[model samples]
Target: MRTTHPHPTNAVEPPIAGTAEARRVSPNAGWWRVIGTVLGIMLLLVAYYWVHKPLDLSLVLRLGGLLLDLAVNIALFVAGGALGRALLASLNWAVVSRGERIAFEALAGLGVISTGALLAGMAGLFRGVFLWLIVAVAFLIAMRRGGGSWLVDARAFTRALRPIDRWARLWGIVACALLAMALARALAPPFAWDALNYHLVGPARYLSEGRIVPAPDNFYLGFPQLLELLFGVAMSAFGRDTVAAPLHFGFGVLGLILVAGLVRRHTDVRAGWLAVALPLSATSFWLLFGWPYVDLAVFAYGAAVLVAAVNWREHRETGWLVVAGVALGFGAGTKYTAGLLAIGLAAMIVVEARSRALRPLLLAGGVA
Candidate 1:
C-alpha cells in the first residue's frame, strides 16, 4: 500500500505510422539498369549511322524529323495505354493497386508503341537505324522494369513450357503446325485476294506517304492502322515487293503466339492445344494466316479480350477487365466481327459484377 503503482515504462512505441519505406532496388535491378543504359547508347549510335548515311536528309531536317518521330510515337503509345487502362478500370478486372496499374499500363503502352515504330521502320517508312535503336531501348527498359511479365505470369511460364508437361507439349505441337503452315504460305505466293486489294495496298500507300491517312476511296474497307502501320515500317526498310509477303507471315505468327498464350492461360495444356488447333483447322484461319488480311490481328486482339475477361472473372482484378475492354475495342477497330464478342463479354461482366456487388464492374463498363 505504501509503494505507488510502477509507471508503465515498457509501453511499446506505436510502430511508425503511414506508408512503409519505399522499396529499394535489388542488386539485380541495378545491374539490369546499367546494362540497359549501355545498350541504349550503342543503339542510338547505330541509328545515327543508318539514318544519316543513306537517307541523306539535310542535318536540320533530319534532327527535326527524329524529334518529331519520337514525339509522335510517344504520344500514340500514351494514348493507347490510357485507353487500355481506362477500359480495364471499367471492367473491374485490374490486378494491382491503382498506382501499380498506372505504372504497368505506362510500360505496356511503351512496349506497344515501340513495337509499332519498329515495325514501321522495318517496313521502310524511314531508313534510319535510330528508330530501331529507340525500339531496342524501349524494349530493354520495359524488360528491366519488370514490364515484360505484365500480361502473363512468368513464374507459371516455365512450367507451361515444359516438354513433358502436357500443356507445354500440346502448345509445342500447335506451334510447330502453325510454323509449317506459315512456311508453306511463304514458299508459295500470298493468297486471299482481299489482302492484296486492301491490307497490303493500304500499307504500301502509307509507306509511300511516310505518314498515315485514311484512304477514302477504299471507304468500304476498314483499316485498323496498328498492323498496317507496322507493315508500312517494314516496307520502308525492305522495299514493298520483298517485304509484304514476309511481313504478313510474321504478323500471322505473332497472332498465333498470342492465341496460344491466351489458350494456355485459360485452360490446361490439352485445352490450350485444342483451342489453337481449332483455329488452325478453320478455313477462315487458313485464309487469314495464308493471306495478308487484318483478320489475324482481329483474332489476336479478340482472343486477348477473352483472356482478359477470364482473368477478371477468376481474380476480380479490374486491370484485367480494363485490358479486356481495350482489347475488345482494338478488336472491334480491326474488324466488325469482334463487336459481337465485345457485346457478349460486356453482358457477362455486368451480370457477374451485379451478383458480387462489386463497384469496379460499374466503373469498367463505363470505361469500356
Candidate 2:
C-alpha cells in the first residue's frame, strides 16, 4: 500500500489506447449507421406511398383492396427478406449480428401472421393500417441494427452493380442475346397455351372482381399469388394490353440482376456473368420468360437462396442461416417443386455443419 501511493496517472491508460485503435479501424461505422437510419425512413415512406395512395374505388372496395394488398406485401416481405439475408451471409459480410438475426426472423414470422389476417378479409382499414404501421416500424428497426455492415461495405455495393465490368465483352454478348430473346417472346401471340389455360386467365378473373376466385377447372394446379397479384395490378393499369407480357420479362431481368449480384460475391466477373447467363440461356427459361407465371419468382428466389447459403458458409452467421430458411419457405410456397430444392439445400447445409461440428446449423435449421 505504501509503495502504490505514488502511482502514475498514465499507468491505467492502456485500455483507452486500445479503444482509440478500434475507433480508427472502424472510423466510418457511425457515419454508415446514420446513413442507414435515414435510408430506412425513406424506404418506409416510399412503401407507404406505394401501398396507401388514393385509387379509383368505392370506400368498401378500397378497404377490401387494402387488405388484399397487405397480404401480398407481407408475403413478399417474408420471401424477399429471407432471400436477402441468405445472399448477404454467402458474401461473408458480418452485417447482421446473432441477436439481430433472431429479431429479423421473428419479424418475418409476424409478416406471416399478418398475411393470414389479411387473407381473412375481416379486418377493415384501421386494422390494416395498424398492422402496416407495425411492419414499417419493425423493418426500420431491423435495417438500422442488422444492416449496418452492408451499409458500410461500399466496395461490395459497387461491385454488385458492375458485375460485368471485369468481362465486358462476354457480358455484352449475353446481354444482346437476352434482349433478342425478350423481343421474340414479347411479340409472340398472347394466346400461348399456358397463357390461355390458367396463368393469365386466373389473374384476369381476379382483377375483374377485385378478389381471388379459384377456378374449379384448374383446381388441381397450385399457384403462388405473388406474381399473379402483380400481374393483376399491371393488368388493371394497362387494360390487358400486349405490354403486360413485358412486365414478366422485367421480373426476369430483375432476377438476373440478383443472380449476378449473388455470384459476384464469391467469384470473379467471368464466373458471375456465367452464373447469370447460364440460367437465362436454358431452354426451359426461355419458354417461361415472358409468360405470366411463377417461374420468374422461383428463379429469383432460388438465386437468392444460393447467395444466402454461400454467406452462411463463409461467415457462419446464424442470421444468414435463418434467412436461408425463410427463402426456402418462400421458394416452396412459390411452387411445390421448389420444396425439393429447399430440402436438398437444407440437408447439404446440415451435413456440412455436422462434419465441421458447427453449431450454427442447428439454429439455422430451426429458424428455417
Candidate 3:
C-alpha cells in the first residue's frame, strides 16, 4: 500500500532561522524607511530655501532652462551609448554579464562620438546643425541595429536582480550622494582655473571659428583634445558651457562604474562596493570630480583598457584585445599621459601571455 505524504510535492519550506532569507524583513520595510527619510530631508531643504528666499518666476524660468540643457546633454550621451552598442554588436562580441555590456557600450559609444566630433571639427563641421545631425544619425543607426533587444535584455537583467543586503544598500547610498554632489557642482557655471584657461576656451574658440584652429598662445590646446572635442559638442548643441562640466562628470561616474565592475569581476560583490567607495572617497578624485577637465576622461578610458585587458586574459577572446586597444587609443587621445597606461598594459600582456605574446601585444598596439 502506498503511504500518504506529509506535504505536497510543491510545498514551500520555511526559511531557517538566522539564515539570510530568514533575516530579510517582510515587504522590504527597510527600503520604505530609507525612502521616507530621504523624502523628509528633501522636503525640509525645500521649505528652508523657500523661507530664506521666495521662489520667483524668473528663478523658476532659469531653473527650467537649466533642466532643459541637462536633458539635452543626457540625451546626447544616450544616443552615443546606443550607437556604441550597435558598433559592439557589429563586432560579433558576446558579453554575458549585463554590467559588463553596459560599461563597454557606454565607453565605446562615447569614444566614437568624441572621435567623430574631433574629425568633424577638424573638417570644419563643428556647427550646430552638423553636431545635431551626428547625434540624430547615431540615434537612428542604434535604433535600426537591435536597440530594442538590448533594452529588453537590460530590463530583464534588472528585474532578475536579487535584493541587496543592508550593507550594500548603505554603501550604495553613500556612492549616490557623492555622485549627486558632484553633479550639483557640474550643473553650476564652471569656474575651475584650467577650464577657464584652455578647456572651455579651446572649445569656445572652436565653436566661434567653426573648426579646430590652431591656438599658439594656449599650449595646452596642442595636447590630444578628445575631451575638449566632447565639450565642443555639448557647447555647440546646447549653447551653454554648463553642460560641459556635467559631460566631464559623466566620465567620473564611468570611472566609478569601471572600478566596481573590474573588482566585482575578479573578486566578489562586497569587494566591488569597497573598490567604488575607496576611490570615490579620495581627496584627489574629488578634486576633479565635476571640473571641465580631461583628467576624468583619462581615468575612464584608462580603466576601460584595464577592464578589457583583464577580460581578454580570463576569456582569451580576441575581440576583448581589440576592445582594449580601442580603449587605449581613446585614453591616449584624451591625454598623452595615457601613453603611461599603454606601457603598463603592454607589460601586463607580456607577463600574462608569456608564450606567444607577440601577436597579442601587436594586435593591441596596432589598434591603439
Which candidate has the highest lDDT of all?
3
Each candidate structure's TM-score, on Cα atoms with residue i matched to residue i, is 0.56, 0.55, 0.81
lDDT of 1 by residue, 228-321 (tens): 5544544454353334444455445444545555555555556655655666776666655556556666666665666667677888776677
Best by TM-score: 3
lDDT of each: 0.54, 0.54, 0.80
Q: If both were scored by lDDT, which would come out higher, candidate 2 or candidate 3?
A: 3
Instruction: List residue ranges in candidate 1 displaced over 4 A.
Output: 1-111, 114-137, 140-175, 187-191, 220-222, 241-267, 355-362, 365-368
lDDT of 2 at 301: 56
Stretches of candidate 2 above 4 Å error?
1-167, 187-189, 241-244, 355-368
Query: What is the Cα-based TM-score of model 3?
Result: 0.81
Name the 10 consecutive residues with the lowest summed lDDT in model 2: 120-129
In angstroms, the error of model 2 at 365 is 5.5
As for model 2, its CA RMSD to the true structure in angstroms is: 24.1
- Candidate achieving higher TM-score, 2 or 3: 3
Which model is ahead, 1 or 2, in terms of TM-score?
A: 1
Error at 312, model 2, angstroms: 0.7
Measured with C-alpha atoms, the lDDT of residue 283 in candidate 2 is 74
What TM-score does candidate 2 get on C-alpha atoms? Answer: 0.55
